[model samples]
Target: MTDRHDVVIVGGGLVGASLAIALVRQGVEVGLVEAAPAGQMPAVFDQRNLSFAAATVNALTALGVMQQLRTPTGPIRRIHISRQGDFGRVRLEAQDYGRATFGQVVVARDFGEALEARLDGLSGLTRYRPARFVGFAPDEAGHRALRIADAEGERTLHARLVVAADGTRSAVREALGIGVDEHDYGQTLFVARVRATQAPDGTAYERLGDDGPTALLPRGDRHWGVVHGVAREQAESVAALDDAAWLARLQRAVGWRIGRLVASGERSAYPIARVVAQRLVADRAVVLGNAAQTIHPIGAQGFNLGLRDALTLAEEIARGDDPGATSRLAAYAARRREDRERTLAFSDGLARLTANPSPLLKPVRSAGLVAMEAQPSLQAFLVGGAMGFRGDVPALCRGEAA
Candidate 1:
């Protein structure tokens, strides 16, 4: 006899786990399969800083996941954007929008640990640890028959809907023959935690220069999380720098906005890229999270976008219809179209425009920022996008149950 579930989520990362919780709460039988063993942290859940948009926080709060976080999070009360050498500067404050804060920044590892802590408590949800998804086939009943390999060897499972929440290199997406538009930015991002001379005071800084954008997000009370983007050719050399040298380089790139960087933590670097799947849904399977689309991390939209993907799909599944029905998945894809397109464009455009060294374009970019600062409507638009308020807002995002 084959094990079965109403929905089988193929990845146990943040989005997949969140989706499983959402579905299980609705009384849907969910099976979560992860390649890593239980309690093991993946690279996605490292020391990198994760800026959760306000909408994302609401959604996670509604799902009861936010309360599980053991580590402290830094509130982003204001965002300061500027260029290396330009008169253009834009500042957005949460109070301007009648909110206490725009977003919250948490270490990725802490958030992952919170998600892991709640996984076992979810009713009607089963977790398959250290399991690899081998393949899938269509069953006679028009469902998905999944083959998963674990310590006990290959086992067959069936699901009404097979969700691929796997990371960028999703096997399920590949199995479905889904094509993607991939762009390697030829840049690398170095992330680290550093203590600055001045207290964070709930301010986040985004500095764009000829090299790339350097973002310093508030981490804890005394520490700030640094995301320094550098050319791919020089990434190795930059990453090889000692803590003092790295801090010095970061200080020069970002200026004296945050004061001297006194202490630093372990640094890690990864190449940056933009990837969007041609199709989000296929047959009885659907891809979510990084599996569906991987955006540039400039605005910290990647995980927030993925969280929305999970919640929206959950809403569709909660409709009590056939989870994998063509119409259902189609609706999910349609609902996500506008948000996905807009976010991809915004992130991609920002990465390109900010990193472009064309002196001619510098003033144009600065002028745009200056204009946005002067226009209340334009500022609101920017705030809305930053808060993850695009397209049809989901119930969870509004702090309502799905």
Candidate 2:
């Protein structure tokens, strides 16, 4: 059997789902293929908390994705970044920059539920749930043929544009003949919800070191979300620790920043790796989200960057008749070039620079932090990127429809 659509997106995770919402709103026909069955969320949709930049909130709000959240989200009004044993630190307040909040933190599972809800009964959307992407066949003029398998059976899907949002180990990307630059940071990040002696007070804290970076983000339930990074060699031992032992380790790593963490919820661990696609577009297809690039989680730019990719592509498709035209794909690539490159560099550089154990980098790191704290221009630049206002931003990122 064969199906047809304006766009066929593989991997209906966060980015693909967002793109569907955005494109469907523009009257585009979309086929969303997801491996997970309905009401049974994938492993990717877990209890980890995500730090949404302000621009992300704007874009998501514009797509009507934020309105369906079941749980409350915590706003980040302040950010505190310092290196372990460093003499200087940088503190940024959204109010000082004429903004009420930098961004909101939403639990990954809650956001996944909200996305599923928002996708309910949407026009111009055909969901192929519990479907697996087999591979791509020959192209038919401007359209590409996709082989997909589901409960019913195998079928062919013809799409004007095929988007691979399948994530870092993207099978669709491999079929599309796109190469990636991979980097293993040798760090494993363990995340969980924890209670501290002092409440979060709307501040997000990050302490960087070669021993591994520790971050405490505000959560909706008056608890802080802790992300403790450990060296790759020690990940197994760290993951096997009891809750009490883990909390104690966290307390030691972060000091008394948010006070002692007295308790913790369930824990999840993910190994850190950086993967950047050589090209964003190939033939009549393209990649989005982690399929296009995966950065170090230190700056929390992974999803934010991918969300921008979806929004930008949506903007291009909305403004043009040929959604899969080379011109349109080129335009999307062009629009994303500066933002993607800059954000990737920013995250990668921060990860490497902060984690370097060499004694020589300490002063340099301290000076950078001190400079950011003292100079309004430096702070503004930092805040602007954190707000997702960098490069050729799409209209949706500014709270406007494309």
Candidate 3:
């Protein structure tokens, strides 16, 4: 069997789904493929919480997805960063920027459900659920022919463009003959939702030391999402501990930044790394989200970057550009250059710099933090960039109506 569309999107996760929404809003016909079955809304996927920047909120509002998010979205009015044994720290507050908050923290499940609801409400989207990509072929015309399989049999899908928003280990990226630069940081991120004795007060905290960087992000309730980086060997030991033992370890490692940790929800861990693709587009196909780049989860730039990718591509397609044209693809790559490079370098550099345990570097790091706190312009720039406003932002990110 065969199907046809103007655009075929692989991997119907947050990024792919968002891309589909954006394209559909632009009057583009979209075919979305996902390995997950229809009506299969998995359990909240552990206790992951997303920190959304103001720019992200603007983009989602433009996409009409924000209205569907269910939960008490907590605004991030302050960002506190410190080093365990350092003498200086950087404190960023929305008061300095004249904004309510740099961003908000949203539960993963709520965000997913909101996105899924938006997908469902989309009028011109064709979804291929529980379908896996078997292979792809790029023709001389710059169109891609994809082989996908489901319960019945294999089928061919032809589209002007094929987007691989699958994930870090993307099958579409592999089949497209694109290479990636992979870095294993030798660190694992332990994530969980914990009820803290202290109220969040709309603040996000990060403390760096020899073990690694640990962050506490505000959730809807009095709960805070805890992400602690540790050696791979120690991650398993930490994950296996009982509730009391885990709380004790968390308290000792995190100290009383948010006061005592009373209880914890589901706990999970992910290996940290910096994965960058050699190229963003290949022939008539391109990669998005983690398939294109995967950064350390330190600053929470992973999904924000992916969402930007989707928004950019959607804008390109909406501009009446030929989806399969080399010029159009090149333009998309050009538009993403500054933001992509800056984000990758910043995240990677911060991870490496903080992981250094040299006594000499500590003073330099502390001085840098102090400088950031003292300079308003510098703080605004950093905060703005962190909130997804770096480089040439799409109209949607500019708070313009979609």
Which candidate gets the maximum lDDT versus the true structure?
Answer: 2
lDDT of 1 at 40: 92
RMSD of each: 1.1, 0.8, 1.5
Q: Please list all clashing residue pairs in model 3, or write none if there are none.
A: none
Q: Candidate 1 local accuracy as lDDT?
A: 0.89
Q: Point out the higher-scoring one by lDDT: 1 or 2.
A: 2
TM-score per candidate: 0.98, 0.99, 0.97
Task: Report every candidate's CA lDDT.
Answer: 0.89, 0.91, 0.85
Q: What is the Cα-based lDDT of residue 364 in candidate 3?
A: 87
Question: In candidate 1, how many clashes are counted?
Answer: 0
Worst 10 residues of 1 by lDDT: 135-144
Which of candidates 1 and 2 reaches a greater TM-score?
2
- What is the per-residue lDDT of model 1 for residues 86-202, given as tens digits with 9 covering 90 to 100? 787899999988999999998989988888877777789888889999998558595799999998889988999999999899999999899999999989999999998898999
Rank by TM-score (best first): 2, 1, 3
TM-score of 1: 0.98
| lDDT-superior candidate, 1 or 3 | 1
| Full-model lDDT, candidate 2 | 0.91
